[model samples]
Target: MSSIRGARVAALSAVVVAAFALSACSGGATDDPPASAEQTLRLSAQAPPSSWAIGNAPGGDATMYLSVYDTLLRTTPDAEITEGLAEEWEYNDDLTELTLHLREGQEFTDGEPVDADAVVASLNVSREGPSTATNLTAVSDVTATDESTVVLTLSQPDAALLPNLADVAGAIGAPDVLTAESSTLEPVGSGPYILDSSSVAGSNYVLKKNPDNWDADSFPFETVQFQIIADPTAITNAMQAGQLDWIALNTPDQLAQFPEPKYTSGSNNANGLGVLWLADREGTIVPALKDVRVRQAINLAIDRESIAEKLQVGSLHPTEQVVNPNGGAWSDELNETYSYNLEEAKALMAEAGYADGFAVTMPSTFLSTPYEPTFSQQLGDIGIQVTWETVPFQDFLTKVFSQNYGMYFMFNAFRSADSVDVRGATTAIFNPFNSTSPEYEALIAEANSSESADAFAPVNEYFVKEAWFAPIFYTAGPWVASDKVTYTPAKTFYPSLKPWAPAN
Candidate 1:
């Protein structure tokens, strides 16, 4: 993984230097403009927008949501938070109240003022919306104290609140459009671009640059078109044929097709925490998983390093903890605690009175994983019968949240304004439905109350000790783009176009 990443960095640096030289020698010629000077950007996207409303859109489709609406706070590709719609924000000493000062002189696409009242309405809508409601669980009330100031009062001291607001929850909408039923179809926002009415739903979307937008100069492109292409092969074909300017490659095989010079590629540490959900820990649905020994055995059954090497295509870092490796809460000791030991795993299963093994069902979204067969084989060796079920990505979430399966595979990379916010990641996975341990809850409360990384270490340790989750890896992937454009990937699961610029 290190070698692959090093080569990508070296190649990207060369491409950037060449781009700068070409720009310097151009002499501001408008007649013989560079290929990138064709400002209309056509890109490929994996997830199509379900609705025009930012709050209703799936959280994973950030590329679409961010193109239509701007958040109160903007997160850079390097994971640094900067001002967006809001000029500044501060939390009270007790950490229960948060105040946001909106940037004056800004207006929504509908010519409405981007004031505190608009922000308050937008946030309240988000709080009731499906996409952001779970993240804003700690929020109690939102109020507009003044013309340009909005205050959010939380029921508890939530360390993840700011980060949650930085996501879809903080996207401010036009007051008039906020109550309209067609807001999901025809949206009004204060973002750099406005959704064009000519856009064809599901197939493609066109966004025209908003002339009144404050950050219009930074966007550069006059028009941006997003083409929905879920198939990897189709996306690669579109890029090769010059129909698409940018796309993300989930595997190294897809990335290898786009060579350097003609294409510039870069990678970011995936904010993702790949985990296995053993939902029936109490044996209400699956009797075998009730024993602690059985759960511990399940943890040691699979070889995560091998999975990363083969399935991840040198793009992931094998991990045992939920916190990202870049974050301060990550612990090397916890990562090494559950080393792969098939013999021990089998022994533990036998000790738990499962010598004859029990039948269990595992649900998956993808057709297969690099180590899926091996994972099942290992369990079979310990007398556990395995059954596999496949479902769509949307249905996958519904099943997990409804607790409809015994075990399932999932990944989460919840990002907030604070780059080191471990609480955001932990809370995203171990919510009320999934986690019921009182000791773990107490540790989480203590960690969330403190601003120090050392305080959160114990919570991560507790997650590992209790075998709450079997974390597989820290995933990362390449963002492949034509040399006509220079692109930087965001440090989040969902891709955003904010970091892309013309190569010239």
Candidate 2:
């Protein structure tokens, strides 16, 4: 199948951790095929979806959403925009208009032709629909130039438009599927793979493969089953018992128990934004947080090394910036500003009249297995009494939307390749904080108005300097492959069996 070739040149699939790979080596085949005629891969994770609704579901559902959907464009493991359903694409000089060239003979699993109109309808639904995760609201109109071509006209130049389109929530579906019922069903896409079957039986889910993929017949595995096993010991037991081949190490103890799984470490963009929200409550410690000294105290107290040593799984990289190190435009200018300094933290606390170090409640989501608990402890060590209120991912979002939490994790899902001036980050937090920063607002406008992406840097610098949002480490997961299963890591997404076979 022909797909966009040029974006691959720019590393379109810029993902923090490039551990997702095909299961085979480059130009090498699995030496010994599995004994079973139909290979069933048992993949395990802590994330289990309550419903497959992209617009409504809380966090922890990205894994399933990504695997079972398709977008017009995708990010490289390194965060570049590569081609997907569209064979080729071009952004106008002003960055306001984008044209995508679709692959010929592409059809959804449900037999609907993957045409330009379908793409337009799918995007429009996400724009006007209840899917808040679909960051394409900036788009004003979408028109099919022809059967194989679609043109997207944004209200303004959105530098991150391509990467935003890569979002799983923005996955294109059959027009009729959206109209069928309010209930969720299998999403129809025109990617190289398809969801053959998915069922949540008890705590486990089974997802098979569609043999009618548009790509070449190189993918070795025929079926992929995702098991939602909660117990770390149970996961280890499954691995030892040969009942499971791939299992995520949820905690440090769990990772220690199973030391042999090949560990792949990288960064992700899910780390919560560093924010100093103005608390609206009548009586609260947050009014003090309005002071820059207090905010600086919070920043200085963060010991990223301890968190890395204690919480980072399978050798994931430690970071101090929200955009991540692998993210091309990530600014290190703020690094010295938020560096770990207990003495400085104490001084700032005293300066803010909190020499006693006030106690505060830190509401967080248990869905983020690595960061929340560690972050709470980091603040606790610096004389700030931190009481963690672990809530579900959905609850966290609602609380944030209401601005009820003094401090919480808000993961900024970037839709475009890492540009220095991040419109999504600004739009997500800035609008809530101070939508009127002429400089910040102007940057967003300028980024869209730039003749090319090269002109976006000047405006992006304002965000990095003003500390509108604190930077945190990238949140990438470990990709461990059994010795028996050798695959190339596809950094842009979760590991798949597409590129591998059984090793001799």
Candidate 3:
């Protein structure tokens, strides 16, 4: 099975290379300038869609969804919520109900009107979809109250609802296309670009400008092509050869390869928590990890600053909390508590009755994280033995989401606009590690009910004090683009086309 998957991936890469070559010569007239002079932009990305269905793809595939469909609301890199399909929205005084007013005279590419009914239909479909189920867990009902008004009623007050709506979960598809069985292959949306079916999935994708789109003027490119080149070396080679206009720099080393005069580069802090998972707090996997002191000891043992400076080479910011620095829940007091002290860690380990230390197993992935070696070494110094279990990327994701690991390290980007968004991020990632403690449950409930950052601060402080998960850092990477196009990288983990424009 592994070999078969590898063969498919290799074939896909070859197809992308071929399609990219073909795109340069196919579209223009003989008198037209060279392919590089055309308004079309070419991008090389790591993941292409396995399934184009909105609900079937992972939440991280927001860029792909946004390319074809527009959400009810849009979130900026700074986490601000702005209008998308819906022109305006407001929550009722009690906050259990949200009312949205649709933009006037909008239509999907299929020529169906985008109104209250359309919004309700899309929301209903998303609520039942696997990728979006968690985001809409609180939503009880969606109703089209009138031609232009749609009301969403929640079982309880949830601060993250609006922000989640700004993500891929809230993407609105055309009713006609959505109801059809071929919806996955032929998506119809009201966004600035329409997906061209001529391109193959998982290899290459072509998006033609939607001239009839309401926000047509907002999009500067006439065409956008995405080539799924999984190999990092191939992506760099393609960029240098001028076959690709934009590429994301996964490492700081790639920064030097794209120099000035010919290319432009930009970066922003990624919107997620880089977490050290000390899962199995209930003693399901490692008996020693059940104690809160043990978790705190592990947190104090690792030198996060050194790892960021040496391994990451300043590409990431060492973070003690899961919330973004600008978020309302971020606390200077809490961040100060995470100073690395070996003696303190040793003392905590003794207090937790593990002075001799205990052994724990962790799964290893193909992608090497800076935390792995440092975590193992520091924990070993404090008498903890770590046994590594090597696994593929798919198996790793399955285990992490299934809560089958004792210890693991990974990062998650939370699309946060405020303190309420901080709480939302907490719920989305940390809920799986939750225990049956009444105090913890009460804190979570209060955080969920909060409407502002001030109300959510205590919950954020509580998680930090408990040392639930050790946050390593906030990551940011470079987006290298050619001099012909002007682009501003979104403060997100993924690249987006919405912020791109022609250079002046």
Candidate 4:
């Protein structure tokens, strides 16, 4: 969404796939070092971190970025705001301004002081970055008030700012490293670990403890290695072979094999559950989709429960909304809002004057195909035929935003009301046509106006009733770890290097 026309979208390729679905670095204090600091926290990554640019370490590079850079704030497993690099923080009475006091004696790996000026520089680059720009949408200015003090002026009270800081949007890169010629592939950060020379760019990454880390004792691993394994079978084999402490399990069979007491499982309702996004709400590319009845008809055609039972292996729950059931913005009333009814869908299609059906072109990728068959076939039966133009995984994001397709599939993390708005709002990248009605915009405004999660309840209901997203189900992301590696799954969708402690 940040300057797609600027072609900065090319910078976003590494962060998609498994990386986008993972969220949160839940804030915690390890008062005591792990039982064994000499242990290595070996984990399987679905994708690899390919960039070291500021605010560029989202998606697969999230943990890698977290390892190399320290965010100003940290989020706990509860999704509560806490401290990371900054020891203290405060907001003005109106909540438009925020001040951060960094921890003393901290410096970047390149020997530059981790001061307010460095933070301001990093924030400046991030304000226009592909991912961070959207996160800092409310910030009007960032200033270095003092050596350890940084202040932010906001255009409005952004409820998502604090949590965003805990995520990739908060990563503070060393100014010198950021400007270096090779920094794109090489990083210079002040986090708990540093990238080892033996590390390969895409295959494997080996990180060693930062000799000068301010909170050296806080992290449990002395060394960490992330293996890029794409196949679920390979990840499962790696875990069984003791090559991995945990795995980003993919298939239901993989999840089932890693049974209870021996292996601990953690899951959160991720946004990747085959959400069928109707991008051409204005009917720029597909005229029939412009009609509200046509859109509602599509929602009725999806057999969400079947997708959950047959494809998802009953490990996940089916639904019609994108909100995480555990989050405050979730509403039980909206979950089963659309029941599978082909006849009803046909009637709506006929009422919209498309009784004979219309053909549409759609973008698909390696990641989206598994969920395609049912969605495409169900629509076909109702006279709405889909023509998929499969693109490489790397080209998928750019193709969708190019406005070349009327519909596509997307996977993202559902953290708050802001998360939903970025995709549904008129300005969101997902809404290529920027289509919206006064009533829909009004609900969005009301939701953003209030910090209370309750306000978003209406917005969630509105999208479901309007059939903005034919979300097949409320999907869950499950991780399998050895019993010896116990962990607390934060409200965040992904686990970074911080949570893995050496089991007693």
Candidate 5:
């Protein structure tokens, strides 16, 4: 139920205002007094850093890379595929290779023709590049067969090939523009927007319209500024001050403040899975998490209904499956069987030898704070005393990934709607038989190798019913535009909302 909005929302909103101003100047304002269509959209965020370059680079930031750049394909909330840089593609009978036909005439801001070579170059960069999504290393090779045709060969028959390409790692940019250092701050891509600047500490990113875009006529906004505001109250206040067009409200309390059309609710196909990591480290709580019983007890004690109501602000529905309700070929199996039950949780704790109780501290960040209360409440109901410590996301990433924190929340968005598409990465997390799970690895492996979607249904059922992960809710953040801005409705999140043209 915790409402949250991303800082990128404010950045795009600013660009939307700027584009409006340009529109007014282009058209004569008549007797109503010549008002310059030139709009200087100002956006405010609670504590967003001023600079962050998110891309194929090592220090890449997520919000910058996704919000300002474009992807090869897009997936809808229902897991359907839509055109991105590639207008269409076809796979061989074996599903081992895919040939994509790039859209004609699409070019980077630098005017480099978006051709087969460009596609190969983009993929190669990520395949061997330092990126959050380094899994592309699994790609065998990329061959440019013709001007617009590029064929991709993977190590295995990846049914989720196209959908995976929709990820940020697949952002298509110019070959020449990419350099070891340039990636840190400079971004050159075929998306509607271009990177203008990045904050000193790599916290925020600024973007502008790509005038040379093949669809420039449809590209609306002129400029955008994304700040690293991570605080919910500050995000809400910014909206009230007209400093933001749209933001991802992070908590239920934050959502209640909005009246109606001004702020709306939508389901994001992505979901966050609760993780109680067990790796040992200093000043950490993992030593206790190593016990499977403890992990199970925590999952059982969660009150999904209360959390959804308090934080969702009536915008979302609780989820059981890792996939969203609108999930595609992979999520037809999700239902309400995973309800909350405090009694079962207590029993699990007792079985774990903690009949009295255990005290634990959860390391969390801005994105996870709103959910902390709900987590704490549920644990308390089961005789567990929980204290949550708030940490910055950047710091947490640097610290927690190394086992610095025992328990935390992990977020995974569906790279594609296809079941095969999601299974690849998700398998890495839940696979219990991997060296990480030595004992229960079969549970995760079965779900991953199952040839038929139906065959994997049982394994998938176990993960959901066992409460291995406490599911929250799915939410699609609303993109509220100033009526003056005009845009093409995109099925995915990559298309810049600000580049939308201004009303004449």
Candidate 6:
């Protein structure tokens, strides 16, 4: 795995709450004997998969299913795009239509032929299903023009379609299973492995290699097993005692226990720490937030470096803009746009007529509580008070888009500039009240249409200048593996079977 890259033109395997590793640390066992009997790759899942059905799959964390489903397209170990069930695929000049040429003689566990009709049926079922439907909204129709060809007619152009095909959205299921209500309990995919029935629902899940797999080498292990463990300390202890092969180093600051000789580590380019103020740019809920001066002042009040140190996950450098440094829209100069200046912050607040300070309601979940103290103490000094509303961890996302909050903080997923500029800024799930303006919409269109990723420069600058959101840092998540396990990150993806290998 030279690099994690297959860029719809990118890929999330999710991390732990209040954690994901910060840096990469390489290790070796040159002087020790290599373990040869452990061929079955063993690891832990952040949580168990709720359903085996691709359409009704889990959101963000698909660590257990990546090995069970072979999508229409394949993403190589290096994250490069390649052919899968559909041997060849092409898009029309305007990019409104896509054609997929299916491979002959492929079959699912249920003996269903992997043909054009099957692909169309599978995709159509996923289009209407939950969890996967959002990515396929632009697809107007799916039709098998012939026995070997499937065409997708879209109402509008989508730039993320390519790499997205390698994800759950591109997963092709047997037509019978797709139509069956029991599909969620029983998976009938043609990937490297099939879910073993011996497994329990939430405790442990196992996968046995698919005898008729098309790409067996991508997943070298004959047996892949996952244990649902939420505590990082427990995971480290398991790996230390040789009970596990791999786990997420969610608590990067506590890596002293996973010392070398037995363990090695790596990370993925994944996310950014930030607070989405939600819609209400006009300050309908919190009038002080409507003023540009107050928003900018809030940006200045943040001490990114301190937050990075306290969080102890991801990079040490605090981020300065919405777009990641790797994305085309990123500008190095923007990092300097909002440096810590409490005096200047006070001045801006005073200018906005908030010299006496202001209070606003904010939501707090287990996933976001780690940073609450920093915001409370830092912002309090600048005259802004925060009142927290406690919400259950499972209900946080539902509360975010539905309720009006002055701000909510979390590590935002950053696969590419397209995902942030398009999905985060324009979609109803993330932007319900249409927080963006016509001017920002034009910039988004430009960035999406441009041949180069750099077309996002204007958009990145605008995000920082407008101070609609406060970005603290960018991160490449951490993973610690046993000496016998070789790890390769799947670029935008979370840890999965494709990136873990038996060192032998």
lDDT of each: 0.64, 0.50, 0.65, 0.68, 0.49, 0.65
**Candidate 2 global lDDT:** 0.50
lDDT of 4 at 350: 95
lDDT of 6 by residue, 104-152 (tens): 8888888878888888888888788675677787799999999889999
Q: Write the per-residue lDDT of candidate 2 for residues 15-65, one digit (tens) a residue.
A: 111111100101112334444425665665543544444343223224445
Model 2: residues >4 Å from true position, as ranges? 1-38, 53-63, 129-134, 201-203, 216-218, 250-285, 310-318, 331-334, 349-359, 364-394, 409-416, 419-436, 446-465, 470-478, 491-504
lDDT of 5: 0.49
In order of lDDT, best first, we have: 4, 3, 6, 1, 2, 5
State in Å the error of residue 469, model 6: 1.6
* Candidates' RMSD to native: 7.5, 7.3, 7.1, 4.9, 8.1, 5.2
Specify the highest-TM-score model's number: 4
TM-score of each: 0.86, 0.75, 0.87, 0.89, 0.71, 0.86
Question: In candidate 3, which residue ranges exceed 4 Å CA deviation?
Answer: 1-38, 177-181, 251-253, 368-371, 418-437, 448-450, 453-455, 490-496
**Candidate 6 regions off by >4 Å?**
1-38, 76-79, 251-253, 267-277, 282-284, 313-316, 420-429
Supply the TM-score for candidate 3: 0.87
Among these predictions, the greatest lDDT belongs to 4
The sequence of per-residue lDDT tens digits that candidate 1 reaches over residues 149-208 is: 999999888766665666666788888888688888888898878889888887778888
Q: Candidate 6, overall lDDT? A: 0.65
Output the worst ten-in-a-row residue range by lDDT, candidate 2: 1-10
Residue 454 shift from truth in candidate 1, angstroms: 5.0
Candidate 4 pairs with clashing backbones: 19-59, 23-493, 23-494, 26-75, 26-76, 27-75, 27-76, 319-473
Model 5 TM-score on a 0 to 1 scale: 0.71
Model 5 residue 167 lDDT score: 55
Over 4 Å off, model 5? 1-70, 76-79, 104-106, 135-137, 196-206, 223-231, 248-294, 329-338, 352-361, 367-377, 380-392, 410-415, 418-459, 476-504
